[model samples]
Target chain A: MKKINIKFWFVGLILVSFLSCSDNETETLFPDAPANRAAQRNAELLDLLLSQPNGFKGVYFTKNDEFGGFTYYLRFNADGTVDMTSDFDTETAVESSSYEVRLGTTTELVFTTRNHIQKVSDPSYQPLIGTGFKGTSVFQYFTNDNGTITLRDIRNRDSGTLVLTPANFSNFETESVASVETSLANRDAFINSTAVTAFPFLSVEAGGNLTEFALNYDGVRLFANPTKFNDDGSIADEEFGIAFTEDGLIISPALDVDGVLINEFTFDGSSGFEYVATKEGVTAKIGYGNAPVTPLDAYAFGVRATAGVFNMDERFKSSTAFNNFYDAFAEFLLNTYSVVVGNVVFWDLNNGGQPYIEFITNAGRFWWDLDFEVTNGIVVFTPTGNTNASAGVTAIFQPLLDAFIGAPSGYYLLNTGTYLNFSNRTYSMINVDDPTMTINYWDFSY
Target chain B: MKKYTYIVFAFMILAFAMACDDGSDAVGESQIDTTPPILNDLDVWLRGNFVSPYNIEILYKWDINDTDIDRFLHPPFESSVRPVAEALQKAWIEPYTQVGGENFIKKIAPRQFTLVGSFNFNPNSPTITLGLAEAGTKITLFNIDFLDFTNINDIKRPLKTVHHEYGHILNQNIPFDVTYGEINPADYTAQWFNRSDAEARELGYITAYGSSQAGEDFVEMVSEMLTNSKEDFDAIVESISDEESKGIIRQKEAMVVDYYKTNFGIDLYELQALTEAATQELVN
Candidate 1:
């Protein structure tokens, strides 16, 4: 989750002595067992107030009149941080710091969220720190009452009577769409993973009736909000909302030009994503992140120095060549992935918050010592525990984990015939013959 | 046999003589094929596990034998069947057997249990019947698919439903004190779900569902006492600000205890503790 950023240096000086409340730093300890039955009931109430409700876990809800009357949700994960999502849009305002759940009074449950903002439009930015929250929010639970629970925004006076419903079996412990924050996060990861942000214009196939035009088009800015750039000069704009799928990338509906959205941009990997507005006779291949060094400079997919395909404008060869070098290369990469497991360059580990990978296998459900790495656009599991013949399995699946860990972007690791992990967090095997299969994923690191 | 034949022939002749009738009546036909739907292994398990011990039958498969044919309902998921059965065993059946003896339940328990996956909702009246005990013989429970066996709250509510329905069954068999209904009879309304719990409690009812009627109120009071600890029940009674409402709740609590003791030879408080401990295993 990202954090909110405002002009906080000056604001901090002004309110340095403001946040000195005794309840600010609450204990994170689980309560001890109750002595009697009545105490047991009290302890149960406290437990619900404290722990992540089992099965659709780490999902929290809040309502505020900050933007009129709207209800937003927070995805409080295993990291103890909260991701506050917008009700009107997919924009998520994440907590600047971690949140804590503490007993406000004998009866009330208080959850505090510090200010931070990670625009749902942009998933790449490191959240900026904010001044503070507007005011404290209060949550209370009542049984056999009007509703199961409620949250009141003390600042805005918007009261939300919450209904946390239990989902069915397969959805157990999975991210919920009803909890908007996690849904957006999950959606963003999927979209960005499919290289949505990578494609700016993609490909334009023009055939109806075309005329020659000069290629002086540098000042044409497409997406809004200049956010940041990686060390390799990759741009991260805060206003680019995307939806990625197995087929192609889906841009926000608002990006449509005259009711023609470049909805399906299939990045064939050799060239850039090829997009065409239907009936427009305009097909163009797009590239990722920032615009080219020069407006007319050719943008190619990993092959800029050699002979490449020309970026066409009207009936003219306007910009750089997009080489067909990766077309056969992408297919070749998919075929020998099992062999490429040991050939990985590096494992980019998710360092903070101890995000676990549940390896539910014949090796006997290892969860304690776990880590994840994203390399070549695929997620992989790396557990410290040795899992092999001792726990009762013939062949070790460490190579498979290596393959999954090294699976590049837009590819996932499954046994011989498994479908795409639709939620994407979970990975499983299709072959019953394989000894170890099915790994449940909980990604605390963005 | 000869005398009967002679009488029959004389009667037939007399009837033929008296008949000035045209043949218009047609006999009602029947679809007479009698291959019963093959009951599966769940039935075999139920017979071995429940029926042989207590003469109880468990039905989880779709059966139109005695159901409302037009109502939309489905069977529990195959995976949920055993977990639900185990939870039923742990929470309801075993506790009763321990407290009231094996013979006690064998003599008085419902003979059949029907499980459904979804709630039986009535569109005309906004009420969903979670459990129904029919004539002290069968108890039907809905939403078994949603029950998470590891969680106490999930198991407790169904057990509460079982206990409440069984209370009704017991009432039907031996009946409660008539004065139990005569305590506070004015606020009983069929539209009980419309009112809030606070409003219901203020009006001298334990829950909104209890305010449905005197009969439901009695069972609800009994179920609450059996399922909840003394402290929890005391909190509810104490939370009611009105003194008269408090007094009424106390009276209902006393009558429930008396009903359990005088009829079943069971101490209500001890039963509550036992039930609480059994359920605590599911959660803790």
Candidate 2:
């Protein structure tokens, strides 16, 4: 989950405070109202409130006139957005709503979307609207504080207070999508660069041991010539050459020299040249005149350059190439368990506040350790223990831990203290002789 | 011939002696036997001792045969049927009387009835197969063979079923203020059989099979509510999807509240809380 900006709350508080004091006649009581009194007041209040990073990070409590009470955590961001999470009896439902606080004689806080407002009050309590009851009703602001706000109930007598307290923002953990994209791009680049060298090649050869030659062929020249003759008494000019025509040479019908057909030869930029007349070809030097560079080297360089650009483009364009890696990593952490076995104890660690499975032996007591990496939304656990252990240990703990970590929703690892009455039971350890056993239970009051 | 004559004479004399003995007993007895069992009037005696104010009508139907008894009732014994009868009496019938009062039961009487108990022998079927009120008569019991008097759970099952069916009877007699059309507009169909129980519960129906129609769902909810067993009902609620289930739960709750308020003049929520707490105790 993204961290909410603090400016939203700051602006809200400033508007609320200004509205609360606007009714006071302090300026009018003196003489002619000071020029720019309202503007000056606004600037000073804005500076004081906005200068300090404002955030509404707290648990809110409100009792509906009909539906009893509910608690929610409201997080106000600097971008004028609020994230509100309500933990109902069955599951936690979350909604995001934007608010615009209007400062006048009275603070007017208006929710931008009416649908976002959950009418906490029971419908029956309200007067019927046609066949059914009214869906929503609003309240006026009565008081405001750093961590709490009280709203004046127009429909009821007593003022309803909405208390806000700091909550563990880290609890709302979700995987970040950006990190996955970067890693995939890097992988593509490495593959493309290595593939250029092994690209398939083809070549040709000409006549005899004229070891070097230079001529202007296709606006370029080369000066290496090798000449040889076949056993058939036909001259085999095995040489590399640059062709002036786009369709260089046809190897089917042998090229005739003075109306006498010599032999057939294929051309490839690599392997220099070969004699077509010889059953087991002979090598010859062939060169293109004034050629900028070898065809093979030029093509290889171009391939490398294209590969580099392709990688760059992929890194920016394809989210799957990089983002998938992070997504998979997050998924893996959610599913696996870490088992740590010591000489005496074994520990199995998992995610989602589940109890750590602890096993004790003569050597020590092992427990499952849970650690959350909030920024990455990853939970890591290492199953470390005595290396020289029986296979039974792994077989016993691994599968059970795996099932717990992979269980679907509604399966939560709540603190045992929440449901189990610990005061009634006696705690004991197996290996340790000490009779005095201590257990630390968590209290999730907020 | 002489031996035959002697035998015939002896037979006649014996017959005459037996006749004389039968006639002499009435003349010999002088005392009027008035003594009852140590736990005299046991049915009334037991009812008086218990604090439960529910007047359970135990209808005895002797139509069940031995074969049907074996199939339906565990431990197919005449003596075993009593416990099941008693459990149904206490769990549902008695509780309804206590909550709704004797007048309520009277309005729906004949409070208790008995059948020949020979025609039907299966205890489970006798309890579930017969409709509570058919053609203006509420048939509480059919055959004793269909009930396992010893198993408290089995006894409670029919009792709950009857109560649920009775709720329907009452609702039909004196219409509830529930605007059923507004709650759900979709028509129930045979497609309901394909759905899981959770889906039915989420739709505010008691069982997935209840989605077959509005009437069946309503009856199921009533039955489930009266039985007050979380094991029987909580799973149905939990299995429901979040969005669709909430509406169903709320609707059921409202209907229950309205039923109690309009008819029984009792706080339904308070009663529900009590019933829920009791169910939890039984489960734990």
Candidate 3:
């Protein structure tokens, strides 16, 4: 299926080209072979090529003995120029370049293009890589039985076969219907539209620094999310309209900033897309994508808090006042949510080891429930507490411990085994209760 | 009416002759490939940057029939090409032009460079070829696919090839002294690959392949002297155990140094230092 698709891609919108279409040997093409006409042999062949019907498509087929199969499309203009498009074959058919046609035993036309490399299948072809460096394909065209033109590509002993005939794609009319204001009301129908595609957006700054963004299109709209560095470029909120021109689908209208057009979403349904943005003579190419990417997930915050302490500030000047504040805060936290404090969330009951790890983030997984010493590390529970008491609330906080034993964070013995990559990350926020006492809280990504 | 009847009769016969005559059915002259050569940005880079200045054309497109088609090969990615080009301009071309004077390389340099991405593995032997200098006009370089312009060693591989091939080209332009090769004539062999670099060094040869032929040895000495640090060459000479073999290598080095001064009005040591600095700029 992939092979067939690639071939269809190469033999793009075929147009038939032929020298003569005759079923018999005794055929006269020039209705009136005028006596005044000179022997304009090559000119006559050119006339035959140019006089084809308006929608006549010409296709060149080459079965390269070394480099597999390939095709090129040639459509001649009345003004002596040939427009060509190609599927990359043994030789690339230079687009919008003039091709040569001449009269001999068979007609000869040479196709030329840059940005092409000849790939071959024969083992013998490997040794001469640096020797032959011709960037053109010289083909000799012959009229075969039944009027089909067979062209033999005589470049580099490649012996590639080129067949030219009248060609048409049955669905050209349907494919040409690029845009209709369908104004899709829902996601499913819009996403399933044949035109919708994920285009990898390449953004070039005003000075020429390039970055990539995956512009994913659902049925109704195309979206570019906030990247790790820049949050303002969320295309869902920013993109204003979709207008599909003959060139392609322009999802966002061109926006001008400081006299330079910057954020405009436009893509032709090809392997790549380019549009002028931010710079007049410079257009950035956003690569076309066939695969949808996984969206970045936002981190969820749990009702967790950690209170920072100082030795003796003026606000917490009295020991009795500090005790009262601590009791109230600890009670509020424990009742409301799962809170583990003092850096270490869990200490193994048997080994008493703290789980400290660098952010490789792929910590091991577990589902076993075991005793964990969770803490708020507050000395609030002491009766009129001694000023120099060793500690209070050092034992397991059963409620917090029970809530997360089988969960991801509780299961991983940090610094052991493989690690899990993150789902999301959140910034750490600190809430000040008073000047001296602040609660710093954060949620984990993994 | 009698004169008009004769004119009409003559026109009819001519029309009939034109319509019926189909001998040979030849239409026009022999076909000439009339299409103009295609020039992309890479071609422009080679022309405006290198060829326009130095009269050289760099062929990076993988021409398979021109390549060793028996081996699996690919061209350097389009993005990967410019770095090597820029590096060549910096390390080899610019430095030579700087040292030998601007018009020096412009007057005598290889006109074409064929870049092959994969190393041209010798099918007959274990040793891989870095490049080939064709009749002093063209140079073919292998291992372009793996050229990291940022890596000194990677840059050195091709830089070395260019200098080595340039040596051959220079020799072809004004042949090198034959007496330089006579110093180590008995050590030369076709089995240059059989020995290791270290073994060849012990045998008073700079590289294993340098021992293959005298012409190669002289150029190898030229390329090695220009690419490697002076200390590195001195270290190699110092490592060799045999006194007579060492003396022969010293003689050959002196001859190469003298050939540069006498023929090209260049100091080989100065060119080596310039190339070394250019290579360091890439990494640093």
Report the CAPRI category for model 2: incorrect
Whose TM-score is higher: candidate 1's or candidate 3's?
3
What is the C-alpha DockQ of each candidate?
A: 0.01, 0.00, 0.04
Fnat of each prediction, in sequence = 0.00, 0.00, 0.00
**Could you tell me which 10 consecutive residues in candidate 1 chain A have the lowest summed lDDT?**
A314-323
Query: Which candidate do you rate higher for TM-score, 2 or 3?
Result: 3
Q: Residues A1-446, candidate 2: write the lDDT tens digits.
A: 11243346446645655565454545546442343453343334333223323223221122222212233445554444445544222223445544444333334333332111333322212232111111122334554455345544333325233433344344431211111122222222222322111111122333443223221121111111223334575543432222111112212123333344433233344532221232233332222222111211111111111111111112322123223432353355345533332222112212123323344433344445432121121122333343333566545455433432222211111111121342221111110111011111122111
List chain B TM-scores, each candidate. 0.83, 0.58, 0.84
Query: Which tens-of-lDDT digit does each residue in B1-284 have in candidate 2?
Result: 65775676567556545544535236543333243412224344344533234343443312223113222211112333355445444554445555666566556533433321222222322112333454324444433444544454555455555656676676667666546534664736666656766666666666664567666666666667666654545555666677665666658656866777787776644444444443333321
Off by over 4 Å in 3: A1-446, B1-36, B61-77, B118-123, B241-244
Q: For model 3, how does the per-residue alpha-carbon lDDT over A266-332 read when each residue is reduced to its tens digit?
A: 4333542343333574454443333312232211222121111121222122223233444555575
Tens-digit lDDT string for candidate 1 (B1-284): 65775676567556544452445344544323242533456557777888898888877654434344444344455556666666667767777788888787798989988886655555466576788899999999876767876777788777888889989998998899999888999999988989988889999999899998888999998777767778887898899999999899999988988988898898888878877777777663
Backbone clash total, candidate 1:
28
RMSD of 2: 44.5
- Which ranges of candidate 1 are over 4 A from the true structure? A1-446, B1-44
* Model 2, TM vs. native: 0.27
